[model samples]
Structure formats: C-alpha cells, structure tokens
Target: MKKLTCTLLAATLAGTFTASALAADYTFKFQSSDPAGDKNFQVQQAWADRVEKMSAGRIDIDLLPVGSVVKHTETLNAIKLGILDGHITATSYFSGKDPAFGLIGNTVGAWSDTTQLLQYVNYGGGYQLMTELYAPYGVKFIGGSTTGVESFVSKVPVNGVADLKGLKLRAPEGLVQQVFAAAGASPVNLPGSEVFTGLSKGVIDAADYTVFSTNQKAGMNDVATHPVQPGFHSLPLIDISMSQKKWDKLPEDLQEILTTSVRDFAYDMTTQLKIADQQAVKEAQANPNITIHNWSDEERKKFREIAREQWKVFAQKSPNAEKVYQSVTKFLEDNALL
Candidate 1:
C-alpha cells in the first residue's frame, strides 16, 4: 500500500511539472482584417505558425478572422483598450482619425511596384514616422506589407480615363476616392466583405478591392465581367500593430523575435501575392466571359496628374499629413519616380 501511494504521488508531481513547463510565456489574441479563405488570411496563419516555431511555443498568437471579435475599422481602439492584443489591418481604415494615416497607408499613383513602397517604409524613415503617429493612440507599430497593384473590377468596360466619367465606383476612403472623384467618377466607400454583393446587386458599377488572387478567391470576377489590368490608382499598405502596454512588457529577445518574424513575413507575402496575381490574371484572360483591358499611357498620365492634386489636398489636412507627404514625395524623387 505504501508503494502504491508513493507511485501515485510521483505521477502527480511529474504531471504538474510537465504542465508548468508547457505553459506559454505569452498568449496573444491577434486579429486580422483579412476574411477567412482569402490568400492573405492564409498567409497570416502561416506567419503565426512561423512565429510559434521560431519562439519554440513560448509565444502563442490566436489569429482571428475579420469582424470575428470586432469591426475591421475598430481594431486600433480594441488594441488600445486591451480587448485585443494586436491586429494586422490596412492603415487607411483609420484615416478619419488622422489624414496622415491615409497618406502613409497608401500613396496612390506614387510607385509602380510593391518593392519601392516596402523600401520606403523599411529604410526611408517611414517606420519611425508611423511609430510617432501611433504613439498618441497607445499602439505600437510592428511592421507592414502590401498586396501590390489591385485590379479595377467593373461590370462595364473601363478601357480609358474617359470611361470613368460619371461611373459609380466603390473605393476605399482616402486618396483613391478623392482621385476617382476628381476624374469625374462617383466614389462610394464600402467594406471589402460587402463589395461582391454591391457588385451583384447593381449597387456599384465598379470596385478596386484587393490583389487579383484575393479578388478571384472572393469570386469577384463572376459578378464583374470587365476588370482593368495593371490597375493604376492604388496599392494599399497593411500593418501589424500591438498595444503599447503589451509591447512594453515583452522581453527584449521576444520583441526581436516578433519584429524580425513579421518583417520576413512581409517579404514572403509580397512575393506570394505577386506570383498568385500572375496566375489569376492568366486564368481571367482565358475565361470567355471576362474581358481584361489595360489603360493607355495617356490615360495613366491623366490619372497621375489628378492624383497629385489630391496629394496636395491631403497634405493640407494636418501638419503630420504634410510631413508624411513630403517624406514620400522626396523618396519618390530620389527614386526617379517624381
């Protein structure tokens, strides 16, 4: 009987020790603005997986889908209030709070590819500017990535700038909307989840939502027959942010693990998105019902001219907006884009 008692006690003690060792050092509830089944969301999951492996399970991030715990636009506040540990979302969603957010979120018609934008943010002092911008909100800027050029999906053929006149389109709330409005098109602001229904119900004549792969996954091509290729207006920047309080509590090694992991993930996402976009474009062209058209250089030039005017208006919104605008423009000029 004494031998049995000793064995039971030893087993219980061993179990307790194992459980204690397995406990995660940090368990974060991280939400993303990407909807489930989208390529971006899948990539986010892969990012979480990589972080977990790199951290050796010391940090466990719970990845939630768009609107799972909070509205897409409300993630910043949720993170600040501690309702969520962090979020990966488009920076433009907070443009209403500060025009600087939109200017930094996406500099419409400023760059021809994602690499330029990434370089500007990672090495051109953009990270410091963004960190300063979000400091007042109690959020920490971790890192960011882009979805590359989006397709302008429309029911009607938009072969040139003239086709946009009087056309009703759905655009994100920021520089893109203003640029579209200036080009004689009526721009409506809507969440990405509602875009397909808007197109199906005849509510919007056209939409500029996401990368070609994501749009195809969302089945946007079925509803919109004419999609403009090499989309000219916008390339959105998606950011990873955490609560300042949570960030401050992390150890230096953990912080390095997270930041580096996110940066590498950003590069991976950009490459995957670009490759997927090519496949989507090829599949779209082979479909008989879909018609893909590219805008002429003159049309693109006209759009860029209008975009510059909108940039001036955006810069006038606040001092910070002006600062971000100047920084981006200087980067463009240095790169020979301006």
Candidate 2:
C-alpha cells in the first residue's frame, strides 16, 4: 500500500509540472477598431487564431472588437499606457496628434490599386517612418492591412466634384475631410458606428467609408441610393501595433512569430477584401433602390488635384508630417505615379 501511494504521488507531481509547462507563457489583449461581424474583425480573429496555433500555444491573444475595451480613438493611448496589450486600428484616427499619421494612413488619391500602396508600406520606407512616428508614443508598429478603393455612398448622386458642393458628408478627421471641404462639401466628423444613423436620419447626405463590402455589411445600401465607383478619395491603412514595453518583454522568437503572422494576415486580408468588395458591388447593383455611378477620369483627376494641395497643407502642419510626405512622394515618383 505504501509503495503504491508513493508511485501515485510521483505521477501526480509529474502531471502537474507537465501541465504548467504546456500552458501559454504570454497572453495579450488585442483590440481592433472594427465592430464585431465586420469582415475586418473576422480577419483579425483569424489572425489571432493563426498566431496562437503557430506559436504552439506559447502566446495567446484575446481579440476584442471596437469599443469593447476602449474607444477606437483611445487605442493608441491605451497601448502606450499598457492598459491594452495591442491594437489593430486605422492610423488616420490619430492625425490630430500628427499629420504624419494622416500621410501614412491613406495619402488620398495616391494609389489606384491597394496592392501598390501595400508595396509602398512593406518595401518603400513607409513602415520605418511609421515606426519612427509611433516611437515617441511608446508603441511599436507591427504590420498593417489595406482596404481596396473606398465607396462614396450618398443620398444624392455625385456625378462630379461639383456635386460635392454644399453636401453634408461624413468624413474622417484628416486630410480626407480637408480635401472634401476644399471641394466645397461640408465634412462632418463621425465615427464609423455613427455613419449609418447619420445617413439614415439625414444628419449627413453622404459618407466615404470603407470598401463597398464593409459598407454593404453596415447596411449603407439601404439608406444611400448612389454609391460613387472607382472611389478616388481614400484607401485606408489599418495598422497592428503593440506597446513597446510589452514587445520588449517578449522572447525574440515570439516577437518574430507575431510580426510575421501580422504581415501574412495583411496579405490575406487584402486579397479577401478585394474579392469581397467585388461581390458587394455586384449585390449593390442588383438592388433596385441603389444606383452605382463612376466618376469620369477627368473628375477623378480634378479631385486628386485638390487632394494634392490639401496634402501640402497637411504636411506643413508638422516636421514629422513633412518627413512622411517626402517619403511617400518619393515613392510615388519612383513608381511614376507622380
């Protein structure tokens, strides 16, 4: 009886130690600027799942949707303060702090295709500059995902730049808003959650939100009759970032895994969004109440012209902005997009 008891006790001790060894060493709370049910959020969740599995459960991330842990605009500060472990957020949301962020966020009318912009960020010194911009805030830029050309959903048809005049449009707070205002439109600053209600209640006449797919998912088609095609205003870049302190605490291998996972996620998301946007455009066209209009190339050129001026104004806002602006302009020039 005594020998059997000793063996059982030894076995129990080994089992406890094994279980503890297998448990995740690090757990991060990752918050996204997308609400639950949105494709962006779904992609984020998948990224988290992939990371956990790839890490062999060494690192676990809890993905939270928009406003679940903190307000979307507050994510940067939260990460900096270590109140949040990480965030997947639109960089432009912080443009008020530094126009450099705005330059990195979209560079309105800069790239006709999302992949072009993605290349600029991944290979054109964009990631380095963005890292420098976030360094002061104690945050690290891990990676970013891009949306295809955005849609300009409107209650009234916008055949050209002239149609924007006096129209109340819900635009983000950045160069996009400034450019829209420059085009003679009244730009209202509203969160993504407020956009649908704003359009439905007539608080705003139009909104330039995410791609056609996300807009459709948000039910924009039900309220807006006209959606401008070949969207020329914005192609937002959503970044994944972590607190510098927390990042430094991670093992080197874990850090590599996290960053590589995010980059892979970005690539996957771009392809998924492109396909999804195509489907959404098709669905919107089939809706009897929805009318899709494509702005003439000349009109697109005019909008880009106005946007260029606004970019200059935004660059002049800060030294950092100038630096980011020069980098992006050089990239465009190199690619002959300038």
Candidate 3:
C-alpha cells in the first residue's frame, strides 16, 4: 500500500511540472486583414510561428483572417477596446479618422519599389510618424509591409504618360483618383468587385488594382490584354499593430522580438511576391492574347511629377495631412527621389 501511494504521488508531481512547463506567459490574438488563403496572410501566420519559437513558447499568437472576430475596418476600434490584441491591416482602412492616415496609408505614386518604402519607414522618420498617428487611438504601431508595386491592368495598350491623355480608367477614391485626374486621365470610382465586369463590358479601359499574379489568377489578364509591369504608381502600406495597453504589459525583450520579427516579415513578404510576379509574367508571356508593357524611366518620371502636384493639394486637407506631407517630402528630397 505504501509503494502504491509513493508511485501515485510521483506521477502527480511529474504531471504538474509538465503542465507548468507548457503553459504560455502570453498569448496574443491578432486578426489579419488578408483572407485565409491570401499569400500575405500565410506569411503573417509564419511570422506568428517564429515569434512563438523566439520567445520559447512564452509568447503564442493566434492569427485570424479577416472578419474572424469583427469587420476589417473595425479592427482599429476593436483593439482600442481590448477585444483584439493586435492586427495586421492596411492603414488606409482608418483614413476616415485622420487625413494623416490617408496620406500615410498610401502616398500613391511615391514608391517604385519595396526596399525604398521599407527604408523610409525603418531608418527614416516614417516609424516615428506612424507611432504618433496610432497612439491617439490606443494602438502601438509595430511595422509596415507592402505587396510591392501593383501592376496596372488595361484592355488597350498604355505605354507611357502620353497614353494617359483623356484615358478613362477605374481607380480607388481619394489620392489615387485625384492623382490620375491630375495626370490628364479620366478616373472612375468603382469597387474592386466590379473591376472585371467594368473592364469586360468596355466600361473602362484600365484599372489600378493589385499585383500581377493576383490579377492573372483572377482572370484579370484575360479581359485586360495589356498589363504594365513594374508598375509606376500605388504601393500601399500594410501596418502591424497592437493594443497599446496590452503592449505595455509585455517584457522589454518580448517587445523587441515582436518589432524585429515584423520588420523581417516585410522583407520575406516582398521577396515572395516578387518571385510570384515573375512566375506569373512567364506564364502570361506564353499566352498569345496578352501583351506586357513595362514603363520606361523617363515616362515614370513625368507621371510622378504630375502626382507630386496633387500631393500639395491633398496636404491642405488637415493639419495631420500637412505634417505627413512635410515628412514625406523631406524624406523624398533627402533620398534624391524628388
């Protein structure tokens, strides 16, 4: 009887130790703006996995896709209320809160590559500006990523700035629409859902949408025969952020792990998308119905010049917008991008 008692006590002690070892110190719930199958969202999941390993399982992130807990646009508010621990989303979704978000969300026509945008945000003043923009809403901005430069879709060939003269195209509202209009193109406001229909029915000639592989996969290339590669305009900013309150509870080392990991995530995402675009271009070239047009450096410069003029007009929308304009322009000028 005494032997049985000792065995049971030993088993109980071992079980307790195992449970204690497995229990996590922190488990964060992050909702991604991308759908479950989206390439970006998958990379986000990998990022979470890496964080768990880095923290030795003390930190575990449960990453959910869009609408898993709340609407995508509502995530900003949800995090403030502590309903969500963090989010991976486009800052433009909250542009309604401040014109600064609008300008910083996507500076439309400011970036031609992923490295330039990431450099501006990381080493330049963009990181500090993002913190200021988010803190007022109870969120801590971590880092930013992108889908690289988005390719343009058009049924007719648009080779240069000359082709934009009076051309009718579908574009997102605000800065993108305004920039296109300023460049002498007639910009139409249309939802993303209607882009294929609008293009197929001859309602518009071109649209500023997403990356090349995404468009090709969705049959966008089928209807729009002419696609401009190495797109000249619109590289959006995707933000990774957390509830400021929750972030304050984390240890300093954990905080650094999350921040540095996100920066690495951006580099991973950019490279993967670039490879996807290259493969899609190869497939697209094999098809006789499609024609790829890559803009020349000279043509891109002219369009950027037109875009810069509209930036000045948007800057006057609010005080925050003005600050963003000043910061962005200073960065551009310092980098010789101006």
Instruction: Indicate which candidate wins on TM-score.
Output: 3
Against the true structure, candidate 3 reaches a TM-score of 0.95
Model 1: which residue pairs collide? none
Q: State which candidate, 1 or 2, has the greater TM-score.
A: 2
- 317, model 2: CA deviation in Å? 0.7
Model-by-model lDDT, in order?
Answer: 0.88, 0.88, 0.90
What's the distance in Å from true for residue 318, model 1? Answer: 1.4
Total backbone clashes of candidate 1, pairs 3 or more residues apart or in separate chains: 0
What is the per-residue lDDT of model 1 for residues 1-338, given as tens digits with 9 covering 90 to 100? 99999999999999998998777899999999987887889999999989888888888999999999999889998998889999999898888889999988988877668888889889988888999999988999998888878778899999888899998899887788888999999999887779999999999999988777777767898789898878887888889889899899989998999999888988889899989989998998889999888888888888888888889899999999999889988888888876
TM-score for each predicted model, relative to the true structure: 0.94, 0.94, 0.95
lDDT of 3 by residue, 256-309 (tens): 999999898999999999999999999999999999999999999999988888
Number of residue pairs clashing in candidate 2, backbone atoms closer than 3 angstroms, sequence gap of 3 or more or interchain = 0
Model 3, C-alpha of 148: deviation from truth (Å):
0.4
lDDT of 2 by residue, 145-230 (tens): 78678988999999999999999999887788888999999999887779999999999999988788888877897899898876
Please estimate how well model 3 matches the true structure, expressed as its whole-model Cα lDDT: 0.90
